[model samples]
Target chain A: MTDRKKTTIVLLSGDYDKVMAAYIIANGAAAYDHEVTIFHTFWGLNALRKDENIQVEKGFLEKMFAKMMPRGVDKMGISKMNFAGIGPKLIKSVMKKHNALPLPQLIEMAQEQDVKLIACTMTMDLLGLQKEELLDNIEYAGVAAYLAEAEDGNVNLFI
Target chain B: MTDRKKTTIVLLSGDYDKVMAAYIIANGAAAYDHEVTIFHTFWGLNALRKDENIQVEKGFLEKMFAKMMPRGVDKMGISKMNFAGIGPKLIKSVMKKHNALPLPQLIEMAQEQDVKLIACTMTMDLLGLQKEELLDNIEYAGVAAYLAEAEDGNVNLFI
Candidate 1:
């Protein structure tokens, strides 16, 4: 392994605010020259999903889940003060007013910075999300791979 | 300062399930001889509240927050399948059937294992929680103190 400091994040929440926080920290760590990985698991995988619908075969539960869950970061709700989904819109408007980058832009910045974005394969299976539905170029991994990186990490966080 | 591995968890969600997961990880790390810390912040501060109400002065907002938040771990709602307050009770019943320890006992186990439990001073202030309203023997700290522990932590988590 290289001697560079490592930062690994396990993004477990689907909330827009939580995902933004994870990406912000990941981007910050990357800017600081730390090797960073964001292992997206469970609902966190929603952030990696492509916005456009992809016609992929799925089981009944999977299809139901796919229909219920948000397609991408832009559709996600905040953890608190969601107020029947208006909270995210309000926050986005506030963000624009303050010139802060939105979640999608933050994610793009992470990719531009070469931050490793990994979708947990096990959860993808459980959630019935296929690779075709996720953003391109991101990695697919399991908890073992996550532990391998986090065990040696200087900053390991589960967001 | 010691050679022991470190595991630091920032408990940001007050949900019963989330708090249980955080405590489980902390207890597990402590069992493995890792120096462990659980920094309870934001809604997480609710987990440290005493079951009985205390006579503490508070502003209108703080009082409103206190009234809105759960009294302690037992009163906290589950992150999912809450069903308007049935989830925690259901989970507790299931835990009993499975012989899994409940959150309060899990917290006790962590204390018994010498795992440090810290209440985030900043969030406590923002949430209007008082020292008298929390459990005895827990430390109060801020983000800087959390970072000091987590910077060198082998397994750092924000739950």
Candidate 2:
């Protein structure tokens, strides 16, 4: 418990709060006094953008979804099945409201908390993005890079 | 913006922290003053057990993995991948640490939050479970049942 070691999380999804979930978990891990690292890959890279402002849906169905559904990104953290057209937005707003850490903060906190923030090299290549496109705080590595970390122990999470 | 309705979320993952992520998201939804429902099925059913404890690694390597990886169920929420032995135990410890939300509480939360909690009847029949075996709060239905809730434009998440 008190002697807990560091934990690494590999986040694959790009949705706002799904990525934010990594932040929450990383922050929580740091809170529990574990060293935490987050690796962002594929769609997950969206949140790492320096000035990322992906638009919230404003159409009718999306609007209707917003009404009948939750209000922010914190509620929409699922990677597989998606429901409301507006789910991701709601999840985000809630995360913001809750002061749940953002990717930028998570990265910074990981630094302050000794958590690692890595961006998947393969995902970056596939997306035609350079490492510079990511937030200034990220460390770039390959799948092998993550595997090297996961190989360390039982606590690895593919978030 | 003000005209937007509350978003609804279906917390559907059965994996370790994925389930917890669902709860965190649901809790976030609740914070947003919206509705949230977590439909438990298959492996996710394990997280809802009244007597079962969440999994943690006892092996030296596992302990090491546990420390270096995500620490709890709330931290392990990710889509399925072939990561050798790291999957299940990571799921367990987290479920245990989160105090495990009961199927009933998930259901009640849905009711209170104006979210619908539906246990996949197909998964139940396939898994040899009955609605009665589930916490009393859960309602049983097939894909038709889930679709009934999903058909509306509310938020749906398959964790």
Candidate 3:
């Protein structure tokens, strides 16, 4: 295995389905022995939020931003046909029926598989999300960090 | 050139940003000499619509469906902060200043690079979009067709 391949995924959407797809791809790539890195930016940062409120010192706008967006994968809405937020519930039910892991579980699985998770520092600053607001064990980086990794990656995707 | 790889993308979002990412990846993959196939399903089918009205014989539902959705890539709204459809235009100006191609032009580049475009028949049926409502030179296919192609693909994405 001298020639280990790399997969870099830029998760730019915070929608449940899109985030799920990112983890699915990352997990699959990891399963095949490829190093996978997911860069979470902008709306994608929603997937990394902690479900429980972690009182972190922030400005009023940051507090409002965190309050308004979904806390975590479980709370994110579908990209379309959200239908007053029932759409995510419906999709979860379907996933359960199919014995597929929900978004939260998928993220955990990717973590267990040693997939590198990088949260975008620029987005966090813009959205006013503090480190305490996000889940643990994730790296914080800028676009240059992602581009550096993607430069040598055999597979790179922006979603 | 012997072990040429393949990339398959399942485009399921019609949002301007998402659709742009899809075409960008498709074009990048094609430029690398990989055989790329994009399966446009559900909302993704919206991206393939012709900007001009196509005279196609269809049922009332199909006519209504066509009328409701954005005509083509040029008209798609951003997934968030659309602000009554101004977000896409703002993004377009940014793209132009960056010397980046607009979504429509990106789609055209992918096509010229010989990327395979597949419209999901099941989605078309469900959405009541007739074949005539879409652009020309695209293959209409069901899930099985996509699966067959993806089976041998090295990179598979759902966006």
Candidate 4:
């Protein structure tokens, strides 16, 4: 292993605000020259989904989950004060007013900064998400990979 | 400074399942002889609350927060499938059937193992949670203290 510090994050929540926080920290760590990795698992996988529907074969439960979950960051709701979808809109407007980047842009910034983003293959199977459903240029791995990175990480987080 | 590996967890979600996961990991790390600290913040503070109500003076918003949030681990809902509070009960029953310890008991075990439990004072102020409202023997700190612990932590997680 190199001498550079490593920061590993396990993104487990599907909420917009939580995902944004994860990306912000990842970008900050990358800017500091840390080797950063974000492992998306469970509901967090929703954040990496492509905005458009992907016509892929799936079982009934898988189809139901795909239909129930949000497609991408823009469609996600805030963890708190999500008053029937109004909270996300309100926060986006507030973010614009304050000249802050939205969640999608923050995610793009993480990619631009070369933060290694991985989708948990186990959860993808459980949730019925195929590789075609997720964004391009992201890797797929299981928990063992996450543990390998986290064990040596200077900053490891499950967000 | 010691040779023992350190695990620092930022408990940010009040969901019963999430809190249980944090405590489970903390307890496991402590059992493995790692120094563990759980920094409770935001909704996570609710996990440290005493089950009984404590009469304390508070502003309107704080009072409203106290009234709305769950009093303790037992009262907290699961992050997913919380069908109007039935989820907690169902999980509790399942835990009992499997002979697994409940959240409160898991917390007790953590304390028994000497895991450092810290309540975020800033969040306490924002949520209007006084010391009297929380459990005894736990320390109160802010983000700076959390950062100090986390920066040196071998396994730092924000759960």
Candidate 5:
């Protein structure tokens, strides 16, 4: 018998806060007995890999960039309008101070929660990303792959 | 003199887990005498409106979707992710249990904290939205407008 609860989320942005939030949510969902999966595409792909050195920038132009763009994900240059501002920074600091898990730890938590992690084939190919670039145990998938998972009455969301 | 000890967050993602996490962190920031602000745009706009009718569907599919999505703005479609499983429904539930604020109320709290609320003009235009479409008392701006506010270096973020 198939499990009745499932959800699919495609994470396209690779900003620290966005990814971290997803990780936290996936763990919370798991506590509720929901199966989870994450599809990383475009800028979000940067986070799936283990060796990426991206840091949440805290500079003048970076600050300005955050205010106009939609914050972190928008700043990853994903062909969307930028909405950068101070609201997010405050939250990040507090989370960090309260000992929020780092990105790697968040991914680990998601995995522990049975959250499936997928890398978008199109974005990976365009970006020239190799399987070695992403962390181990991650599946490479296409739009069809994601759609198939979403087809099982599981909700699909584009984050 | 420029006021000090204010921490602001510019929330761009409407993901339920992320939004609620930001608020929990905001409450933490407030403890440190930091002011918090959450700017809503695009998908995040859904989390801000007070009169949104979040219709929950019945059956397995609806249950799955609900499990993946957050109930209100704090549990928003905030991030640009498509969580593959256990995403929406779980987020929605926890937000309700935690008594988290919707995007509108979160905005109001920021105002109460003297935090500025700015909506992105570019996102509004791209999404074919009007100022009237947003909650009242929101200051509207293009990228340039948000940049002007971000210029002040009180700490910023993109979530």
Candidate 6:
């Protein structure tokens, strides 16, 4: 059998820094030719939000969730020092100065690198997020799917 | 060579849930006979604080850090839904109901299980955290020490 490694990350936190770390690791591992899969769930779904609103019908709670949550990676708040949303902007400028890609660009890069992006269907249902709300070209799956991929994986992380 | 594995966790976030997560993973990995080392730094040092004040001489910034930061894990505020510090208390009560160990207890259990606890010396210098401010029977090290342990670690987590 060929010697290959698989890296699976369960991106559970929606925080800006954590999501950035997840993508960075995923892309870095993929660059090493490791088979990579990122399972985004719960708050992590916010990372996949489209910038423009999609006119999808939802219940009151779901509507509230969608409206209250940040629209996309560019709008995400820092977990700390988020003084009325200014911290994220400051970090964005710092990222720019360091020539680090923004979260959107990082996500795009991970996708381009053939890193599998799977959204937890259960989380989407619970959060009232429709497929139209997320970015295109991503697959939807459940925990069983993730477990199958991670069972013999050399590296598994829960972010 | 033995089949034993090493797991190194970098505790960077001082948020209540996040710190709890770090310990939970450490304890769980220890249960599976994996060697675990937790590197605590920056705000993460808040988790290592003793609830009672320790009469130790320190510089002005050190004293200020000791006074301003949370005294211990029990005093840490949640990263989100803090709601004026109610969220952590709520979670603590839930943990009690579920017969789950509190963060302090988890720390103790980790120590008892021989999990290595390393406080980041550079962060201590930066944050003005003196050795006396932390728990006893722990190691003090820098990133090089962590790297030495993590170089061959099958699991390396940055929390």
User: After superposition, which runs of candidate 3 have C-alpha atoms over 4 Å from their true positions?
Assistant: A1-8, A15-34, A45-159
Fnat of each candidate: 0.41, 0.00, 0.03, 0.41, 0.00, 0.08
lDDT of 5 by residue, A48-117 (tens): 7555433443566544433333222312322222234333343333345445455567777787767888
TM-score of each: 0.64, 0.42, 0.64, 0.64, 0.43, 0.65
Candidate 6 wrong stretches, greater than 4 Å: A10-12, A16-33, A39-42, A45-159, B97-99
lDDT: the better of candidates 2 and 5? 5
lDDT by residue (A45-93, candidate 2, tens digit) is: 6556555423443566534433443222333344432345333443334
Runs off by more than 4 Å, candidate 2: A1-4, A52-85, A95-107, B1-159
Q: DockQ for each of the predicted structures, in order? A: 0.23, 0.03, 0.07, 0.23, 0.03, 0.09
lDDT of 1 by residue, B1-159 (tens): 999999999888889999999999999999999999998876788889999989999876567667767889988988889998898899999999999999999999999999999998755765578999999999998666776787778788888
Q: Which CAPRI tier for candidate 3? A: incorrect
TM-score of each model's chain B: 0.98, 0.53, 0.94, 0.98, 0.61, 0.95
DockQ-based CAPRI category assigned to the predicted complex of candidate 5: incorrect
Scored against the native two-chain complex, candidate 2 gets a DockQ of: 0.03
Give the lowest summed-lDDT range of ten residues in model 3 chain A: A59-68
**lDDT tens readout by residue for model 3, A1-159:** 248899999898888888998899999999999989999976899999999988788765456556667889888888889998899999999999999999888899998999999998756775678898888999999766665566557787878
lDDT of 6 by residue, A1-159 (tens): 237789999786888998999999999999999999998876788899898988999866566556666778887887789898899889999999999999999999999999999998755765578999999999999766765565447888988
Candidate 5: tens digits of C-alpha lDDT, residues B35-145: 545555544554544444434334442233233333345334434443743565555566569985544465466556555566765444433344544566767764444
Per-model RMSD to reference: 5.7, 20.3, 6.6, 5.7, 20.2, 6.1
User: What TM-score does model 3 score on chain A?
Assistant: 0.96
Q: Please write out the lDDT profile of model 1 over residues A1-159, one tens digit for every residue.
A: 998888899998999877876887788778777899999999999999999999999999999999999999989997865778866776676566446688899999999999999999999998999999999999998999999998888998878
Please state the CAPRI-style docking class of candidate 6: incorrect
Clashing pairs in 3: none
Worst 10 residues of 6 chain B by lDDT: B90-99
Listed per model, the TM-scores of chain A against the true chain A are 0.99, 0.66, 0.96, 0.98, 0.70, 0.96
The lDDT values for all models are: 0.87, 0.51, 0.83, 0.87, 0.55, 0.83
- Candidate 2, residues B1-159, lDDT tens digits: the string is 233233333343545545656666766676676544555544455344333233532433223222333322333344565265365555555656998664335535645665544565533433334343444455665443333333232344546
Pairs in steric clash, model 1: none
